[model samples]
Target chain A: MVVNASQDDPEKARRFREAALPYLDDAYTLARYLLRDAADAEDAVQECYLRAYKHFDSYRGPAMKPWLFAILRNVCRAEYARRKTAPTAVEELPEGGDQTPMWNEAPETPEKQMLRRFDGDTVRRLVAALAEPFRETFVLREIQNLSYREIADVAAVPVGTVMSRLARARAMLRSAWLAEQEQAK
Target chain B: MTCEEAEVLIHALIDGELDAGHAREVEVHIEGCAHCAVLMKEYQEIRQAIAESDLRYKAPLELRRKIEKALPQPQPQAAPSRRSVLRGFAMGSAVSAMAATGLVAIVLRNDDEQRIENEVVSAHLRSLQAGHLIDVVSTDQHTVKPWFNGKLDVSPPVIDLTAQGFTLIGGRLDYVNAREIGAVVYKRRQHVINLFVAQTANTERKTAKVSTLQGFNIRRWSDRGLNYWAVSDLGADELSEFGDKFESAMRANKEG
Candidate 1:
């Protein structure tokens, strides 16, 4: 089916798409951060969209981004719970098996140069390495530019908790970033 | 307020979560207190750096497609009618042929649905031993059902068996690849069973077929092309009994 289905009501559908489109990428990215797998993240985002569509009738807000994100957050949590139970074959690596060190420190070559962006990639890896809750709060507040109330609504937590967690999450991310900077020297 | 409290509020002030009155109070406090102001600037810089770093992820395309297919379709109409909701979770219909054969007892060339039962039972036991009880969690059936959207094509009927002594722990997205299957997960006195289902046009299916594999007991049955497989490490007799109850509930729901 063409997902961009505005056949019956072009104007209504277009408005929906216009409002929904910008958030889709951010929603999926947040899902990926929460889920750590490409497939599950996609599932979470799609679920968020469907939920948003079904409830679109009830939406009485100036904007739909926060409402949409709240749904995405739930989908991500549910997906995380499911994956936690499912059987997976995890390859064993060193105790702190973060790839940043190995890949960054590896001998430079033309092929590796094509794949380069040592610092940015390192930062990305550190972000992923943070604990799920911390990383999620950090991403939502700092990167996604969501308000504390919005994050609270999305995370299903109190605003006070969101504020505290955001503070701690930033502290953790900053530490991780600093550590990476040190390691790069 | 002391510097400690003011310092924490500095971050909050930057985020604009602080009320106007509190913001004014914090501003006055920070103006009089240089230390808090400096801390506020540091928090702002940290936030700005994070925002400007391009650290935010760009989801890959495959991830987007997979999620789009997996997410739940809106079903405002499906709400009050419980049976229709469960029927929407037609497990057999969603699965690929291979996983369809794995979770249900259908089109088996062999005479033994018993063997299949046993194998499933063993797998169930492994699930328990491994502490893999459920993939999704929500008391609401709607929440649990959408969990399998992309992972399985047929919606496995999620029946809350809590009143029947089997608590509906949740639902999970299961796979047979290129065909998603739904596994309506339930629990009974610490025992977990995955009720794998799919839609099919075939009826006149067996009521009960029991087997044991890997120290687990299983029962397989089908009513109206919807195949049901119940597997547990619980014993053959007990599993058979539970299967009877489950099948009857399903039948009553269907007929009524």
Candidate 2:
């Protein structure tokens, strides 16, 4: 509830609105994918904006997208932990051995055809199913189209980590997607 | 470039994050290597599918309005800023402007009441925490009553009602609707009751309405240019009975 004196500047608030409001949809989209809940995404976006306004003076980052996204990521972290303990999200698939997907399956014609035939809902589901770091990287690079360096700014990781996460995320998505297509056939 | 190096750079290349040198190298690798080429094509398709999909969840209009309302407004200063002056000029014709917008005088009473109830209930719960319930702890209304003088815009009525089963506990300042209001505390058996009083424009009296919220009973009424809400875990009947006795004492003091 403590209001910083700088946050109360009308001129500053005006400048913030001009600079930040245009990305509400983008922020909302990132939040929705991150949280997987509509109401939580809305709240996260609102908190992100409020915090951004509070720290508008301190923001000298690369661009507005990464800056707001970094704030949104911080906000979603707590929600993610809370969600992990919640009964709804407790059943996580175990990871090891067979859990690591076999990727050497020959690219049958059907898998390639399915790759070419992009269904919106199916793509969204596969992306949403990805675990963190990967999910976040994919959404930033593919959906929001942020550069890897920009994503690293938001994710607080090295550019190399962003590169690896993006590559791994794409591989995971491709395999999961191709597998799903194989199943449907 | 080797296929291993090209694999790391393919996504960057597709996303146009790579410089021309790296992009051309990755393209050259993909040209001869069918495996890397297929992987590149699949990654491209995935990115394209996501891009073409209608997955961006636009914030609801209500959320925008809610956030706008919640943000702190710039406090008007001694010498009004130009924006404030313009705002004042706009407000000068607010009635006409509001009428034009067809929202001249529609305050949703239910929403306001619902919001206030939540705030007061939250304040009551917070006060229950250790060292938070009272600013001035006293069993005498005389001491509790004077503690609020000059602190608030209006002096809340603090009546000693021990003889009527509710014992004077203490009082404190609590916040509601973004303003500090007086809270007169009392104890009924083991239950604590907070009587929140705030200044209101309504001079007319409204009968006490008892409502249950979060397992706590609240009896709210507006009278004599002040609004009152008595919140407690006591049963509804006992709480309203306490309200009646307190009102009678207030009336008796006024008449005498």
Candidate 3:
């Protein structure tokens, strides 16, 4: 397909690369979360760049991060479908009482306890364990720091859905952490 | 606002996504109700935990280099030739542009093949580095082949060559170029070999061609519309022998 050929001028290619390359790290982070492998994420980001370059003229938005991420998300979905593997399932949350104290009531402080309980690896695993919809929203909001509107635009969902997904994702992570703490005990 | 309404607004408040009026309502509700207050506190804690977690993964340098190499370089427009003029008359400017695009695509596809080779080597190295060489460990070809049935768009022929020194280890779903492909593992004595298989639009059969990257050997060929890339730390002769055995076995399986 001759996508955006009218704007295929040399200057446009240069401009596109300059604008889109800055978000390479952002794209890689999102792809890694979605694809769940370093090699796959890298490949996804590479393809995202090529596809973005082809469709650069269609990008009329002010920010490049979300636009680039939208393409990356599509690329990831295609890759996911090609793989045909079932979505990585999240383990069931632990049962019983809320042994862990709420943020305001904890005696040791939330920051200290969180640092002790959840390391980088733990956090990544927990986030990766989330289902696709919740995982995408959580990564965009929490990690990429995109606004609700931008996330909705990239995910092709409503702002309200983004808010709820983020909420559910956080709740799931909190409960998973409680489960991990319980198991550790 | 009731606690139920307040609970819905709590996430927006933590995310700084709430409007002034709604924020005020949620704040008032939290102040009045201890239960909602604790939920708010927990939400804040979860957000903080994520913020504090070191989860951002940077793209590796090698991958960056590969991407840079693979990006299409702008070609200098040349003067119109006789072929272009004749074709323009026969078709039009749009057709000529499409022809140009097709040529560029061909060049890009060739470059993509080279990039895919680099990726195969990188994947092999990563598997060894992470000690995740195989996802489904087994010696039985029946078990290994079924594992990829649903995982990949195409089922790669899995065969056991233990009698020939190459033993079936397992298979994994690997991403190369832009598509997911099946990568079956094999063991040659202590050396590990990865046989990557992907479906291709090209129908012609190709003889195996050997190349080396970072001291590792890679042999690639296409047969029955399936592209196969075998990579390993084994010697060139031994790896080629493994490839020969694999190809012949696949051919025999097809015939039978």
Candidate 4:
């Protein structure tokens, strides 16, 4: 391996640590959501940090959160590919069709129904069941609280796409919740 | 705005992503339309539920510790500025003070091995970066070994292991730890290995010590009053095999 001279700079490393270390929790959270396992999340986070440290000089952004999260997301995707256990792609349901008609069927008491659907495990399963694009956008927006612009920057999508994905993701989660509720009954 | 249009903007409104005019428009529509109002409330509840739940997983303490421990130690930058040279001169007196306090000897003894290891690795890396891995390129050990004559006080043993898959490429003169040393370059397939040898007065031969630095494998041992360090990006098993072949060939040459 030919070692590049620029990589030996200690000042660069110190700067990288200072800029990137604070995002460890954010990285791990995204990784857990993406990879869906604690140990795999930890491993991906560690690999992400190492890769980030190596190319830190190339990070010319104003904020490091989106940059670090982007790398963590890539690492998780690669890990998912390696494991070959990515959630199988479900066929896209027709937009506002009979398959998910329950979305429009108003519960008699909206607040009570919303509380019943918010059970932690069910919410987690619903989010995890989303396809990769929607799942990533939802996790970034709702869970990580990134703005649409920030989500666009991290996911390398347009802001319009981020908005659409978030909208579709929420719709899917609502449909899944309704379906799961029907199964329970 | 139609109810369908308001539906598209409901999530954006709840997320604060809409501009004021559009947001006010959506608010007005939702207030008058009971269906849009209920859908908006549902989106708000979903977002709030996610925010209030224990969804964000905190990285475990042990994972944090492992990551922190594995972080690479920063390599000390070698600055050749005039100010640093003057600082070094001033530090000579500080060294004497440390010696007077009986701390210099132990520090120097430990530092010597570490400094040499770092120097050898740096030299190996520099040669690769400079694209000058050899002073004289030759596959035959006889031609390569003769090239070092009269240039150094001691000649490093050169051997050909073409039969064993490690083909001797050439030899070069490299400086490590302020002393001239011999770097014998070899190849196993595509991986290049640098074998650094220098004459030393310490005659105690020891078994090879293996270490890794920055993803490179390093093997060091002393034999017959010469110190040998083999550094490469090759696998440990292949490097150890190269070491064994080199050592045995050197011993055989000495006996003959």
lDDT, model 3? 0.74
Which stretch of 10 consecutive residues in model 3 chain B shows the poorest summed lDDT?
B73-82
lDDT of 1 by residue, A80-119 (tens): 5566577873232333232122213211221111111234
Reference-based lDDT, each prediction: 0.60, 0.76, 0.74, 0.74
Better structure of 1 and 2 per lDDT: 2
TM-score of each: 0.45, 0.53, 0.52, 0.52
For each candidate in turn, the interface RMSD (Å) is: 11.2, 3.8, 5.1, 5.0
lDDT by residue (tens digit), candidate 1, B114-202? 54454345335434532344667766677887776656445676766666677777875433211234667777787777776754434
lDDT of 3 by residue, B91-206 (tens): 53444374556522122367657867887887787667444577789999999999988666567889999988899989877656544578899998889999998765333478
lDDT of 1: 0.60
- Residue B119, model 3: lDDT of 77
The 10-residue segment of model 1 chain B with minimum total lDDT is: B73-82
Two-chain DockQ for each candidate model: 0.16, 0.28, 0.26, 0.21
Tens digits of lDDT, candidate 2, A63-129: 9988999999999987877888888873444432222332433343323343646566777888898
**Could you tell me the lDDT of residue A78 within candidate 1?**
74
lDDT (Cα, tens digit) per residue for candidate 4, span B1-256: 9976786688899989999999999999989988778777777777777877757665654565566555553432321233332333346445445336433221125666776788788778766743458888999999989998765557688899999889999998876654457899999888899999876543447799888988889999886556799999999989999999888887787679
Best by TM-score, which number? 2
**Worst 10-residue stretch by lDDT in candidate 2 chain B?**
B74-83
lDDT of 1 at B203: 38
Question: Stretches of candidate 2 above 4 Å error?
Answer: A1-8, A87-116, B74-256
lDDT of 3 by residue, A76-169 (tens): 9888767765465333334321222223222222333342357789889988987667788889999999999999999988887777667667
Scored on chain A only, each candidate's TM-score is 0.73, 0.82, 0.77, 0.74
